[model samples]
Target: MDFEYLLQLILNGLFVGSFYGLVALGYSMVYGIIKLLNFAHGDIYMLGAFSGYTLLTIGAGVIGGQASIAVLVVIMLIAMVLTGTVGLILERVAYRPLRGAPRLSVLITAVGASFALEYGIAVSFGPNPRVYPVRLGNEAFTIFGARLTYAQLAMMLIAVALMIGLDQAVRRTRSGRAMRAISQDPKACLLMGINVDSVITRTFFIGSALAGAAGVMSGAYYGKIDFLMGFIIGLKAFTAAVIGGIGNLRGAVLGAIVLGLLESFGTAWLGSEWRDVFAFGFLILFLTVRPTGLLGERVTERV
Candidate 1:
């Protein structure tokens, strides 16, 4: 590929990867805390985009065309908070009661939750895709002959900031330390007086919040939102979480960027239609070679 084309592909990969990483954070965090795969995660992401769109439309109407950019930011914050709350409710209603049930049962529950959220959204929002208003400007910046829009840059920045903030929280705060403890040994942590349930719930909140933010960002950048938007991206994000190491937060982010780059290059070299195949091909290769993932710790097989 030409240098300019290479640069452009890299930029696109980073832009898309950031959102993948953001969504994957939820997967990684939930798995770390409870070891249950929240299959409805992608649906939650789709819901977030709808929530953002709704809030933005309402803001636009209430504030009129002359509203300042700050007003939009406030609306987005509200949307994120609302979406995060929904995520918490999902965990409570759909998953919590089944804790420690057969893995197969939980998996079925996850699938059911996924379908419920998707169809529920379809019923409520209709099957049609909605367009997100152009709240962010369309200024392009050139770097190394690669052009990037302001919205892309903003999405990247926000994703990075959230990741960094989460890193600090997990590594520094007392609540974060408790969360880590529970991840390492939920039974032991519960014995030690750490509220295991609360920690797990909080993990979901944080992770889902990140996914919600990504939803809004994706909607703004792509100018479209639909019930199925999360399906492919959610699968990709899960692949990213597994590739990086499901329980490792930083690994999730790193894996997402790598997957994004691989997909971008694959699409450029092969064809867009082969993107999903290429992704799954890599996933299978990694599973065969290193099932624990790139950064996942090796666990001793129990008898």
Candidate 2:
């Protein structure tokens, strides 16, 4: 095996893994706060892609040219806001009502919500893949004999920046403190006059916004938008979250990057068809052995 090829695979893995990390962050955050496994979260990402597609198409009609980076950024932000609002609405309309309900019932509702988002988009956009109006052209440069595209570089950088910003927000900000506190004890937080519901809504918004940004970036990078795109990535992101420790933010990122690298190497060894199998197989192994995850701390719940 060629060393250069191996290096290339590693680079590609990191690039894709960054996206998994972003999506997993949402899963981890929601789970950490409410212990809810939001099946619709992935579809929210698909919505963001469609949102970006719609905005860019409109922008193209007005400008009569490929959207500038600035316009693209604006489109991404708009998509994030739109998706974030959708997440907030989902919490209020669906999850909020079922808060104290059995976990299984809530899980079922999440599945229903996921299906609703999926078919709703299908009905609106038609059951066909839509090409993105703005494509980040494949302009390549070499780094240490590994070929890298300008678009991939930008996506990686943006993803890293967002992850760093999120880390800081969770660590340093008042809202972050509230999130942590609520995660620890919602009843205690409420007793202290903290609005638990509001904080949860905001958490959903922020997490969904991150997923939205990821979707827009993905659409630009891949140049196609489809309603079902998020389904597989959602599973992978969930796996990443589990591998990194479900409720740990940094753990999700670490798991995603590791999963990406494992997939890359696995594909190189076995073939592309075995990639998912390899990932899921690893997930099973991890569950059987180290279920707490690489960075996950074992929490004892009071009976």
Q: TM-score of every model?
A: 0.94, 0.97
lDDT score at residue 1, model 2, on the 0-100 scale: 72
| TM-score between model 1 and native | 0.94
- By TM-score, the best candidate is 2
Off by over 4 Å in 1: 63-72, 299-303
Steric overlap count per candidate? 0, 0
lDDT of 2 by residue, 23-136 (tens): 999989998999899989998889889999998887787855565666777888999999999999999999999988888999999999999999999999999999998888
RMSD of each: 1.9, 1.2
